[model samples]
Target chain A: MKDKELLKLVKQAKNYDSKAFGLLYEQFVSKVYNYIYYRTGSFIEAEDLTAQTFLKAFDAIGKFDGQKASFPTWLIRIANNLTIDYFRLKGRRPEVPIEYACENCDDCNLEETVLINAMSDRVKGLISGLTDEQQQVMILKFNLHFTNNEIAKAMGKTEGSIKSLQHRALSKIRKILEEEDG
Target chain B: MDNKLENALENCITLIRNREEGIDDCLARYPNLRKSLEPLLRAALAVDEVLPEISPSMEFKKSFGAKLDAMVEDKRKKFVLPRKASRKRIPPCVSAAATKCFNNGVCNCLYLCCLRCGNDGCIRQQSSRQLTLPGKESS
Candidate 1:
């Protein structure tokens, strides 16, 4: 939806308009889920985190100032915080669940599934080895296609730092992929 | 040269993302940078290819939708600002009339209808004299 339309819906949602809230949920739920899925790496946990993110958003939408952040960025920030909290509480990072990765594997046969899962594991593992900020920069850049300035704002870093992080992350991943191939 | 490479990679990658140029062509545009940019570009593509943009299952969507509906309804129910309703005050004139009727044994019809009274405000009879007067309430 257009920004103006989204703002109108947000205004309505702030007023407890259920229909408007539902529209907003429909529009953003998947993006939010995908973001959390990457951060948490489990469908179940991602779903749970996604639900909490929306609930928290619902509770606090009244205080959301559109001038400060776009709704998508705001939602991602919430999901990111919740994912950090989940890790902090669990006291351990999650191993990628091949099962969830293969859940929507485009109906591939078993062999194709294995091949794809292997590459997915490699990519995820390489990314997981990066520092938290680097991983976030990579994910926001590659997965969400956010520009450097937007990612900087979301990650609370300067655009210069974001560019540095992205460059370093890409170089690291490329080095890993090259070594593994060799 | 690191800053230069960052800007070049960003520009070429943005071109790829926008489909304005192919990767090979973009890399070709920067021959000196190709060696630096090729592996990263290839690695980025590998990651993007396998990291599929997946959505929640229909089952999950249905369940979350139900949950969100309940939440919106809950907020709808709770959104009431609960204005303190101002009560309608009984008019002072009517109350004064009633109070006078309680205090005197006279009818309140004059105050009620702007007619004469027996010189007092109460629920009693009047004499057989029609004189313009104010009930105790008006007095």
Candidate 2:
């Protein structure tokens, strides 16, 4: 959505307009869900956190400042904070089996599915190794498809710092993979 | 981390992500930075990266939306809401905006409202919008 249109929707939402808030929820639900899904690695927990994020957003919509961050950024920030709190409260992320990540596709070949899921598990393990900010950089960029500027703004940093974080994250993953091969 | 190289890497990664450029295409854009950029770009691209696709199900969205509507309803209830009346009722006069008719005589509506008339039930019908009651000084 264009910034102008988004601004208008946010204004309405601040005024407690249900339809406008619903539109914002629909537009951002997937992105927020995916962010939590990656951090928590459990669909059920991701759903719970995603719901909490929106509920908190609805309650605090009046406090949102368009000058500070874009709506998506503010919304994502809420999801990010909730994810952090969830992990902090739980003490550790439980090791959910990779197979449980997706529903069974009866039509797909079993061998191919197992191979693909294994690869996904390995990739997620590598990403989970990065620092919270670095891992967040990766998720915001790759999964949510946020630009460097948007990520920086959401994160309260400069675009330059965001670029550096992304580079460091990818470089760290590369080194880890290389060490495994060596 | 060279600032120029970082900017180039950011642009190239964005391009690569959007399918507007490939490793070779991004490298070609910054030939001088190739040696440094190529390694990072390779790392960015090399991973067979498929993060989980476990999005919220449809049932979750429907339930959450309904919950949000309930919240909005509750907020709306907190305001000075006007409700439908069988007979047109006057706004209550308990507020400091009470008329200065302190003659110990004819009140505009309070005499009948607080004492007698059934149609004008200001003291009884109960409009919560009565923000302020008359102070002891007024009585």
Best by DockQ: 1
**Candidate 2 residue spans exceeding 4 A from truth:** A93-99, A104-119, A179-182, B46-48, B52-54, B80-139
Cα lDDT, model 2, residue A60? 92
lDDT, candidate 2, B10-61, per-residue tens: 7887888778987797799898999888877767665425553334666787
Candidate 1 C-alpha lDDT tens digits along B1-139: 2876777788887898789999999989889888887887887776666565667766777788888888888867765433222223567798889888776644444444434443554422333233326563333
Clash pairs of candidate 2?
Answer: none
Per-candidate clash tally? 1, 0
Native contact fraction per model: 0.57, 0.44
The superposed Cα distance between candidate 2 and the true structure at residue B31, in angstroms, equals 1.2
Candidate 2 chain B, poorest ten consecutive residues by summed lDDT: B79-88
Which digits, one per residue and each the tens of the lDDT, describe model 2 over residues A2-107? Answer: 9999999999888777788889998889899878776777668888999999999998988999998999999899888888788779887533233343537444
Pairs that clash in candidate 1: B106-B122
Model 1 segments more than 4 A misplaced: A94-119, B1-3, B81-139
